[model samples]
Target: MPSQQDDADPVDTSVAHPARRYDYLLGGKDNFEADRESARLIAERMPTIRLVAQENRWFLHRVVRFLAERGIRQFLDIGTGIPTSPNTHQIAQDVDPTARIVYVDNDPLVLAHARALLTGDPLGDTAYLQADLREPRKILDDPQLRQVLDFSEPVGLLLIAVLHFIRDDDDPKQIVDTLVSALPEGSFVAATHVTLEYMSPEQFAAVRARAEHQSAVRSGAELTALFEHPRLQVVEPGAQSVSRWWPDEAPQPRPSIEDVACNGILARVGPRSA
Candidate 1:
């Protein structure tokens, strides 16, 4: 099992956290009333919100497997929500027991559960860091991250279902650039974000107004624009609803984009510009 670096702040259950709320949506018992309340409100606006969460999770599993199959043995999984089975490490290590993974999250509760449940294959390594995505430098510079991941090799950077939590003022583009820039050439970045583009005008306005306190949903175009870096190239299929990213691997009769309302992208990092 891996050790967890503690966050100074105690867990505040009064306010709803995206991670806890996500766990709740996934039918996990690790959430509090506030998280359930927040998810309930979101579900009221979008009846298929739970299915959206499931599809996003499945997307993460598929992307990890894809990266692992392509010889990506190390991963930096940020915004790792509460311990869900078949986690990033589980899927990657399944493909190769030697795969190393580093999980980062701001929530102390996530850290607590992750330390206990996120133990990867003994042949590999796993470490948990309590950190915020807004501070990419801190995550990149963390001693645990450096110890677990080797910069010389390609890494799969997973931002699954978390980027929407970052508000516009947070400069998400710059944050993503800083992290992607630090990776060596051949590294891959995969991200999934909530979007309202598939919704009707009426539902979009209603959900947007109510969900503003929790997330900053971006359309597929805006989400794609976040990876506008000289060394990054979008993978084939470009930006698509999470359910549609790899429909062949997904369950038959895939849900409509309108129900998923989320976009995912995978970009590979090329050699640094001289």
Candidate 2:
């Protein structure tokens, strides 16, 4: 069994956290009243909010399987929420038993559930790190992460439904660039971000007012801009609704972009530009 690393701070149930709120939206039991209240407020504004959460999670599943099928055996998954079943490691290891994964999240509650995440196929490895996404350097430099993932090989960097939590003032693009730069050539990045593009002005205003302090939802273009590094080449279809990212793999009659309100992008890291 892979031991959990990092000292997690005490969970504050009085305040709403993105991870717990996401768990609540996904109908998981790990969330507290504060998370449920926050999710309810958002759902009241966007009736499809629960569907959006479900679709985003399925997107994570598909992307991990996609990368693992392509021969990438190691992954760095940041923003690991409350342990939903068949997590990133579960999906990737299902494709390749030897897949190695490192999960990072700021939620103390997630760390409390780290033992469940740390279990993987005996042939593979999984480690949970309690950390915030805003500090990419700290994550990359962590010794446990370095021990599990080899920087020399292709690594699938997963930023699913988490980057939007990073405020613009925090320089999210720079943070992404820092992590991508650490990857060797042929590594890939898969990210999904919440968007307000599909909402009407009134709906957008309502959601924004409710989410302002917690999330920084961006437009499709803004989400794309975060992967602007010269070495990062976006895969087919550029940025599109998560529901439409790879529709054939998703359920039939895909949900409308207006209903999902999230965008996903898959990019490959190439050799650094001369």
Candidate 3:
């Protein structure tokens, strides 16, 4: 919450941004006609789009709370879409009042709504930066970010619903490796992405076709390789449907391919290698 002045441009209003479309799904008013149109079209084909969004948000909340309870103090959340109730800082700071978090997103609206994300306990610090994930180094080296996060110590790296925006040629795995390599060994990584794991070849083909016309969706193996630290171990119920990971109560597993298109997981960076 550094800049109070109208120092930056609002997020683009012309083309539909995935973040805005997601906001529409979450029923926020910050979205535009283009965003709503895209969301509506996709939802027409998939009626449960809003449910998926809610489930993903719940997954984020649960993971942040779990990590905070385990004593993590610093977090770097990339692709943090428009802020909603119980955002990352909310969950973490609730557990540890002194927790520090840095939220990064390319969407200008995300920066426009920085005030919401910066609301942290007086003891803890929260910062929102307008940056792209392709430039992870500049973000890590940012002065405000440096003020709040200590790279030499453990930090939670979150990449939820964002990696699909990056294509295979972007070397998403390398990006993760570079970021993870910079963190101390005890750090952790939490990630989620749209996948077509539970669909038939034809069914998956149809799903993929739909997503191709709209968003980026990856396969399970491709997502798993994104976190390839020899030392890191995935938490229980690893990379299953988001509903299955540490659910407060068991969710009836989705019985059909259309029921699940997103997968979520949490992995602890191995304690500093001996």
Candidate 4:
């Protein structure tokens, strides 16, 4: 696993954290009451919080497998929440035993679990880094990441469901540019973000205020701008609802069109393949 501080600050349970809140939404057991409450309130307004999360994870899995199948062996997964089953390392390594992964997250609770449970394939490697999304350079510069990955080769840069926590003031586009610029062309960028376009303006406002009161989330246009750069080429279904992004096994579409709340995409970081 990636290294940790000898005396890192203990987890702060008094306030709800984005990672723990997400874990709560995903029905994971690693969250506190505060996190659950926040998730519940969000669900009260948007009943499909759990379903949206699952859909995003499904997209992550399919994107990883798709990228791994294309011969990319290095992965940089940011905002890696609690060590959910079939993690990025597990998925990538399954396709190629030598696939290397570096998981990054700023949450102390997620870090604690990651430090205790990250396991890599015998032929490959996996490491966890505790770092904030705002500090893309820190993650892109981590020695552990450098040791396991070569920027000169193609790599997968993932920011699933984490960018929403970054407000417009944070200049998410700049952060993304910094990370993607560090990798070679042929690399891929897969991201999932929360949005409000699915709801009526009134419903959107209600939930928007709710998310802002607890956690910072963004709009669809804002998320699209995160991928703004001439070097990247969005894949076929660019930035669609997570449920509609290349669904394999063709999950039965929800009975209603109003079943999703998250937007995501899997784009490549190179000239379009002819």
Top TM-score model: 1
Per-candidate local distance difference test: 0.92, 0.89, 0.79, 0.82
Give the worst 10-residue stretch by lDDT in candidate 2. 1-10
Write down the TM-score for model 3.
Answer: 0.90
Residue 207 error, candidate 1, Å: 0.3
lDDT of 2 by residue, 62-177 (tens): 89999999999999999988889889888899999999999888887788787655688889999888888899999999898999999999999999989998898999999999
Q: Candidate 4 lDDT, tens digit per residue, 31-149? A: 99988887888788888778877887887888888899999999999999998888999999999999999888887778778977788888999888888889988777778889989
Residue pairs in clash, model 1: none
> Per lDDT, what order, best first?
1, 2, 4, 3
lDDT for 100 in candidate 3 is 94
lDDT of 2 at 205: 90
Instruction: In angstroms, give how far residue 29 of model 1 lies from its true place.
Output: 0.2
TM-score of each: 0.97, 0.96, 0.90, 0.93
Question: Which of 2 and 3 is the better model by lDDT?
Answer: 2
Q: Which residue pairs clash in candidate 4?
A: 2-128
Give RMSD (Å) of candidate 2 vs. truth.
1.4
lDDT of 3 by residue, 114-193 (tens): 66556888999998877889888877777878888987778999998898888777778878877777788778899989
Question: Per-residue lDDT for 163 in model 1?
Answer: 91
Clashes of each: 0, 0, 0, 1
